[model samples]
Target: MTSTRLSVIDEIFLRTHRGYGVPIALQGVWRTTGTVSRDELVRIHDRLAVGKLGRRVGKPRIPGARLRWDLSPGSLPLECDTEAVENIVAWADAQADVPLDPQYGPGWRMTAARLAHGGTVVSLVCSHALADARGLIDAAAQSFSGSAVPEPISSPGSDAADALRMILTVLVRSIIATARLWVSARARAELRAFATSDSARTPPHRVRKMRSVVVDIDASQWDSAAEVAGGSANALFVSVVAATMAELGSPAVIVDIPFRTGSGDANSIGMATVNIRGDDSPAVVRAACKAAFAAPVGAPAGYPPEVVQLLPHRLAATLTSTPGRGEVLCSNIGEIPPALSTLGPHRSCGLATRAIHPAAIGPLPCATIRLSTYLSRMDGRYTLSLVSTDDALVESTEELTAAVHRALEKRNLAGTPW
Candidate 1:
């Protein structure tokens, strides 16, 4: 089938159903080293569409979305301008700031312009609520790598439901197992009695503006740093972010980290977004993160991996199966690929990246941060973006951005790559 409608991923669907939408964007500059062909453009479009599901049902669509690649022909030559590429790039960056229309569909847009010089700069803007930022970058890298044309149509799968399903599934099983481990018949019976007697429990808190940060480190350096610090890259990243919040005097914080989905189908990769809320104590945060990282990478190793333990089995399953869960998402789209390098003769290129928050019923933030690695002859660099709405926090957005950069710099992880 050319297209099959499936449910929107948890965060994405929620965003559209409400008024807010995801914005995914990026800009890149590539100096023309070899001949440019229309075939290359087609291939890039096909790759972009590969993973997108239908808006309503979240069903998979072959060649996911049509990409528009417009070029200013050489014949229309104006005066040769060295910074012509920069002008286009600046406009592309401005595009990233525009709000999206949730009713239209997946919030992604791209523009590629040939510069006055032989080089070119490409800009991509997307909604964060639709897909994770890293996912978008990965797809872009694959598209730009070569002229490997994708098969026009591919299988449609229910990939969006994976995150919600997996978490809920794990949660329920954990609860059942924990109950069997810790509760005796009398205790269980007494709990049941208390359940029947207690009434008027507090309402579930509304989703609030998610507070988040973005830091880019050399993907290569991350491992050694983690090993030396006796922590994983994620742990270190979170620790820095948490430390920043502490410095700001925040009593509580919620952070969501993207968990890569194992499925081969592009869409099958679910967002195992993590939340580090409910545990306000620094010791709890540090210990919980440490324990989570200790587990083998592939194994379901994080501590209390199942949250369903907190809910009844039936309810837990229902929540998992259902589309919406009021949760803030934190994700890191790891380093950009080396293939994106701009070598000699390739003078000017544009690399554009953007992030947008998802809209949900409550005030909870559907914000995210993504990083893309960049290379220059003398420097190793990456770009970081943080997406949030004014309703979510009292802190100034500039303050948050500064804190992220400061935190990353303190660890000697990132700075001006130029």
Candidate 2:
């Protein structure tokens, strides 16, 4: 099928949809090193008609409404501008801030910057409700490749008896799980503290500006630093984030880290969100992440989204998701997928990444930090691209960015490239 109903999870995401109401966005930059091709552009445009791109469409106010990727009626212009590198990149970055129209149903937009120096900077503004960061990267690789992407396979068999047995088991266990979840000391403390914080829970009318920063670190050095810190590269990144929160003097913070399971069909993607809580210690953070993602959690692991959708919007927002869940939302898009890195004829050099939390009401995270890697020409160099609303957090963000570089240098491998 070219189209399908917005899944329960998608509907839930749309209810608090980013940019307009809820403020979640995905922005990415693909930098080319060699010649560009119009064929890649055409392939991407074609996928919008027949692939996962259709996942974006849905009717307003209805939960899990039927939606289709209505391929724009006419042909799209394949030609792009030949402009100065600075001008092109600037134009592309500016496009990331533009909001998508929820009603129109095309939840993704593409704007390109053709470098006069003989390359391209491609910018994608996508709705967070549509796909996670990994999903976005996968989509670009899949849909834009010169080769045709593999089609989705058929669903596996299911037994009614087995289904019934599982349902019964869950029914019996939910009582214990529910009780334990609320009665747990951690849960009580989290709610009590979060519910009491006025500045943190101010109503939705008080809109706070959304901001983002994209930072790149040397791939090997990143690994080396993590090894020195006694943790994984991801743990090192999270530790830096924790250090930033500490710099702000936040009292007891929460972080939501989502990782892909790679079990969904090409058209349907889902992920597991691990909320790491407690003090900002590298050991604590690494342990939490490890515990949350130790096993093979195929796509669609958690059932909370379904349950949350069943509740009224206000009640759901208050009880389960957002607001008090975390002070930051982070995703470390580990290594660049080969499908994406070599997706086309353009010899891709590096990739830039960023996420947006467009202006929204209520207290959102201080910032969303995404650490990504590129197919490097140089062994060990880093870069930073930050875009933020004019607010107090920007000041601390500057400090954190500087501190991150300093922390990397402490490992004595910042410029050594060894």
Candidate 3:
């Protein structure tokens, strides 16, 4: 029997959930040309229940021991909406309210609804503690490909013995982490100095309600605009988001880009930051992005994982600082997998992905980040999903949609709002 420990990032998310912060989850929406039969939806849900998305966290018997994953199948069933809906996007947003417990069981939920006009929309919501964008995509692809599901392996030793071994391992690793923590502290000081700049101040006005906008653009046009701007597709995406934030009155935008670290943990992406002005051209932003990506990817800035695991959840939360107002998380999911393009007998016409915070219903204690953008390409269309937590900048979904249009228009690219 083998034991898999939670990664540092995973531990952070888990701690955050247990502390004051709400558990964040990822939502994937796929639009099909026709209705996916109820039976087919059930089959898809069952397959996913047995995949990676199904697992939940298993806490150690003693503190200081790393958390493990309970590889048992998830207990969530296929949720089908009997009535047709006018707006599938709105329905998808509502699905976020559904509860998903990562530590107990059923870390994911799947729902399907038919469009008023035609077609079907199916959504899968997975707790961020269980999987990230890449992990969720892989789970779906594996399920659709008829791949064999691996059975969970039992632990070799007794529970108490396993816990004792893990605690001893943590003790040894904590000593090494202490040395590294000193080095990390110096680096963090430099980061804090940079963050204290006037441009990094929080934006004015605070509102609690979060709004999101989804738009679809022609893939050819998007690619052409990127080429004409002398930048790649990714550069264009960053430029658009930066420009949009700037137009919304953010002086400078600190973009957080997520890259895969080739880890099997729930949150395997390493974060890289790039600061840009609204007036920066796509080419300039491209160069900055390239440099940022080339920089080393490591643990997030905070207390070391070993140190955090030893502390209480509330204490760990107190030590971690809130993100700056100018910060914007930009995730480019790239292309949709072919296996996900077809669900049962229906082919997907569009795909939209975004992260939702179920507990963020009112104003947060601190100023929220300005915006978050998620980009994905499916079929011949590019779906650009935007979420604004700062109500001051984006008062409503209509305002965000208009801002997206203007931003894309500036780049000679146009998209239809979803």
Best by lDDT: 3
Off by more than 4 A, model 2: 1-8, 18-21, 35-39, 59-92, 101-103, 116-118, 148-213, 246-253, 261-281, 291-305, 312-315, 318-324, 358-390, 395-403, 411-418
What lDDT tens digits, residue by residue, belong to model 2 across residues 121-238? 7766666666656667666666675343433423222334433544455555555545765558764554455455434531333224433344555666667777876777677666
| Colliding residue pairs in candidate 2 | 18-23, 18-24, 19-23
What is the overall TM-score of model 2 with all chains considered together?
0.67
Q: Encode model 1's per-residue lDDT on 177-279: one tens digit a residue.
A: 5565464665455445434421322123333443333333455565455566666555655555554444444433544444545433223234332235332
Q: Which ten residues in a row have the lowest lDDT in candidate 3?
A: 317-326
Each model's lDDT comes to 0.40, 0.49, 0.74
TM-score of each: 0.52, 0.67, 0.86
Q: Which ten residues in a row have the lowest lDDT in candidate 2?
A: 370-379
* RMSD to true structure for each model, in Å: 10.3, 6.9, 3.8
Model 1: lowest-lDDT 10 consecutive positions: 68-77
Off by over 4 Å in 1: 1-93, 96-107, 112-121, 127-134, 148-224, 264-287, 290-329, 342-354, 357-383, 391-397, 409-414
Descending-TM-score candidate ranking: 3, 2, 1
